[model samples]
Target: MWENLDRPPLDGRALTRALVDGPRGSWSRVDVVARTGSTNADLLAVADTAADRTALIADVQDAGRGRHSRSFTAPARSQVIVSALVKLPGVPPGSVGWLPLLTGVAVVDVLRTVAEVDAVLKWPNDVLVRGDESSGYAGGKVAGILVEVASTHPVVTAVSGVGINVSLTEAELPVPTATSLQLAGAAVIDRGTVVRAFLRAMGSALDEWRESGWDTAPIAELYRSRCDTLGRRVRVTMPGDTELVGVATDIDEHGRVVIVPESGDTSPVAVSAGDVTHLRALDA
Candidate 1:
């Protein structure tokens, strides 16, 4: 019996044990920390030595970061801040780009099924739900995924980080275009369950990807299915103030977003990295 002496954050012992107790278990271990600057940074620091499939979940993130080095922080204990180390010893470099997409799928699944919340994905890494978009914030951000590849020589290791707002109330939202599971009226708000589902889904997706010779078709198909970015007008902001306004068409095999731009370029532009803002609904 685990007793919370003083509003315990999460029971690491029980969570880790439950992660591997059932047949669907995918993680080797799940470690919970009271507070950390960033779970991704901590995992990446030891990814070289850490066992594959080890996950680090934090109850408090003081200096979390998101894509493009943007600072990401939330009220402590209100979000799920977690990271896992994945070792792709012989996987093709071409397939590494799918990590974030795969993570997005896992999250969407967990949100919809385990948490009973309708979730959508912004291209590349943002997790979104319907909300106000007037502030250049399309669909409220409910979660995010960040995948960092540490090496390629000896073995390829990627630290996949995920942050999901679980219990944050309306008043606690980081931004107007942001929300939490509670705000969305989730049927269940168990952080442990969400983390477990994410790990299992990711592990299953990774297996399918590797078994297919890093073939991205399966993941891409599924990702596209859940992606809200596709089939919508969008603005992709590149470095140096470059921008492309287009209709997100597809996620190409290489994991780049293929968009039919409103610009004169008839060919679909494949974007590998940039800030994406979903624009108004495409004309019917």
Candidate 2:
């Protein structure tokens, strides 16, 4: 699904080639583009015609997107941008919404294994490393995941994109709280190794998801176990001018954040989409 342009292509070919040669349980076709506006956009452009297990990767995205349409920034040749296309079988239509969460679990698995760092999930789909005294929660955002789904007839193509900060220094971090493997004291990690580990992890997670449907309990537990947001005072901004301030309780079976509101309401509210802000801690 790549249209080779006249310009020199980006160097994602090495990674694409490696995955093609690596162990893939269900993945069949892998495509690597040098530069794209967004890997998600590229996958969507050809989603209707592409086969299952087709992976689209780019070296850098000029207009990468994250949850809530936030722009994802990756320096040229310093990060990993990979999107895998999968065809779901026998999964209910409504349950497809949790694919991103499942993919997040896989991302965490790969990061912990490949980088050998303590990576945590920050709700929804952000991977965070704990910050030390000097860094102070500038804990690196080692990786992030985004999934897009399209259905036609008997097959649903889920385009899963994962971005990892492999070699960026502290100065290269996109945000104050962001971090990279190098800055997190990880030795020089090979991007290709990280890519393969992630693909294998994703393949395993997808297999489990297809077999069990969207039972998000295991996925939620895995996420919560590595989550840094749990048990913290935070604000969740919902759509259309609604918000909730509460103690982050737990993630429910359907991948929703269970929150205990400030009004002392014991009933749990499931938050499907929102911006979360962790309250600052006061010194003792």
Give a tens-digit lDDT track for model 2, residues 111-152.
Answer: 777787778777777787777786554575677878777664
How well does model 2 score by local distance difference test?
Answer: 0.74
Cα miss at 182, model 1 (Å)?
Answer: 0.4
How many steric overlaps are in each model, in order?
0, 3
Superposition-based RMSD of candidate 2 using all C-alpha atoms, in angstroms: 4.5
Give the TM-score (vs. native) of candidate 1: 0.91
lDDT of 1 by residue, 55-139 (tens): 9999899888898788977766778888989888788887888889988988998888888776988898988876544643234
Model 1 misplacement above 4 A: 1-8, 131-139, 281-284
Q: What is the TM-score of each predicted model, taking all chains together?
A: 0.91, 0.86
- Where is the poorest 10-residue window by lDDT in model 1? 1-10
